[model samples]
Target: MRTNTGRLSTRRLWALSAAVLAGVGGAFASVTTGETKATTRADHFLQARAAPTTAMPPTATASVTTESPATTAGRPVVSPVLPFNAKLTSSDIPVRGGGVRSGACSGSLIAPEWIITAGHCFHDINGAWVGGKPRYHMTVTVGKLKDGDPGGHTAQVVDVRQSPVNDLAVAKLSTAIDDVVPLTLPDKAPEVGQRLRFAGWGSTSATVVAPSDHLKRGEFSVAKIAPTTLEALPVVPRTVENSPCADDSGSPYFVSGDNRTGNLVAIENSGPPCPQPGREIIARVDILTDWIRTQTGDTAR
Candidate 1:
């Protein structure tokens, strides 16, 4: 779908393309409620889009860099281009083809076995999402920089949890990830206009073109919209620009300001093309501290 700015909305574009998986007899189903319920075959399908009437605060800060023209092009493209040989490890997520699969999104290590990622990344074919339970098939891989293939270390996802209403998700690995040090979450919210860094193995460029299989990274500055403006637009927190594209949906948005600390503030939710003019809203993890603690049974604060 095209946005007011004339660019294709990545989130909507991916959702529509993903529907093809269902057409091939995949068990994909749209989720309506937050609670788990019985699954049934869908008679029709509605592409996921930005829900209207949701409110957001204006001028919030992000921990990444701003977008550039070159980075916004269609196709799988990496930005602030990293060295071709730069070594980085990524978690591996396998999904069933045809319909949306139950595989959760790949994430980066934040602690010994803790990985950070977007909450929406975890899902099943029917979209009846599940988390905070050991039953979820969450997994983490390290020492590999390529997508799909786990280069070095791999571990089973032991537990998955998220903050209520926040886009952040943390997964505990069954075993410790050696060699790679864990990234840290920000203790405080980012200031307005803070530059941030984002990395993932999802589609490198927009979804209009073919998705990329190689790991891609980009930089995006946080753009905050007035809560009134957000409410007026009736924008859902999940659907906003400067967010993740199709496959990058579950990647984490990390801090890249003067503070060298790699604190996480947002997870890719939805958005238009890279660096598009619009408020890229993320589920504010800082605001949902208590809920996160309750779900994980950990004293995060």
Candidate 2:
């Protein structure tokens, strides 16, 4: 099944008519007397049954500037241009024909053998949660700014752990990736109007739904800081030119005070189409810091 933006992968076009796993309702499903049943809304990338009334925000215009020979500047350039290689986080889900899915969301290395991603990414084809033998297989690729880049570390998931309340999950890798430095988890939650960076291998165009094999990064201004989530507005071209889109679930959001160092702040959960005017909900890492430490055996307090 194809969407207006573009053709969707077979793995992505699932029916909501069938019984599916749990998901967050855009506007928390309301309940009334004698009716406790709540309907679920498809998380990010899932085709929307309801057409969005609001159109996406207009792309901002800016004067392009050149960067030093060593460092590139302005907007999230596609991979190999301004490689986000230092952090070592990347989009991990593989697609058919033996390649990583474009716009397949993202995850970060919290430890040499552990990756943190959005909980929704862990669900099965039917959108049902799975364990032990996951209905779907997942592979984590590190040190790869572009999908075709060589010498990167790739590991299959050996185990998975998901949160009970929020949309967060930890995956244990079959092998350790020691060369790439793991990202540091922040101890505090982000505040409103703060600048943050989010990168992924998702779709880059505002209207297109296809994913680019190259890594792309973008900046966002935090608008709301909830206990478990943060809603942000895209500030692309500042650090990136793209917004997260289909298969961009499980992407990492970072808080970089020094602009060189990043602290894992949240996991990309759901949002409207890329470059669209909608709340990009990110799963806050600070609230789940303790849980993450416990799950990954990172006991540092």
Candidate 3:
């Protein structure tokens, strides 16, 4: 499935422009001089985009590109803080190898020790397989506002449960977090054209990484497309197109207007790659309440 990187903030747009110009010029020369080597580099780039760097155990063998520390310092946090809400941080859930190495989806805290994310984000990395047992190897960080580094608390996944068809996963944290308040889930499906806010530690601009692991949040009108429209998209499992990209996987998609009464509608899933514009697909949280309650032992209305 295509991963959806959120739109860039104005400040980030300027920084990305400068970086792209400088890097693209150098990359062009390298591509021309060594086409074979360029292919390998391209492959690595695509692989990073497809799988989370930290999806596997430390012993697992996989090739990953490491960015320079200098570049890391310049990256900005993408989402702005709302009056009563805290943006979800990337550090809350650092992918094993750091950044986009983990599949690029976002997640949200539903209970003290339970987080909700997309099932597809925990799918097979090879993309050759269809359905099977769900994997919980991806690391989840909560309450962080920055990327790579979790501000304070961190937790490893104890278990993961996925819904049969929808892209939903409920994960148990190693320990309960006391500081970060868990968000609530609604019993009803979201309305068409309802304004919603999606928060994550994902890429700021389409293709480029935002500097900090800080939580980034954005507003999107829930363009309720027909389920048939989603079925027509070229997605895996022949399903929807409401997922997040880059660092957004496993992030929360929440309603914004009512603040205290807002409901979490979906978990970040997948979307089109950077430079390609598309809608994000999220695993509908309300649809799978029974499954979630059974797995996480949380009451779902």
Q: Compare the candidates by lDDT and give the number of the best one.
A: 2
Taking all chains together, each candidate's TM-score versus the true structure is 0.53, 0.66, 0.57
Query: Which 10-residue span in candidate 3 carries the lowest summed lDDT?
Result: 33-42
lDDT for each residue of candidate 3 in 107-215, tens digit (9 for 90 to 100): 6677777777655444343532122333324455554455553133445556666554444566666667555556776777666666666666555554454322455
- Residue-wise lDDT of candidate 1 within 21-135, one digit each (tens)? 2352322222232221211111101122222223322223111112221212342222222211111122222223332112224356666556666555554445333465543
Q: What lDDT would each prediction earn against the true structure? A: 0.40, 0.55, 0.44
| Backbone clashes under 3 angstroms, per model | 20, 12, 46
Candidate 3: list runs displaced more than 4 Å.
1-46, 49-104, 128-137, 147-151, 208-212, 225-244, 257-261, 275-277
User: What's the true lDDT of residue 140 in model 1?
Assistant: 50
Compared to the true structure, candidate 1 yields what TM-score?
A: 0.53
Q: Per-residue lDDT for 117-235 in model 2, tens only?
A: 76655554454444444433455665667666544555667787876446667788777766555678888778898887777765555455444577777788898775466777887
lDDT of 3: 0.44
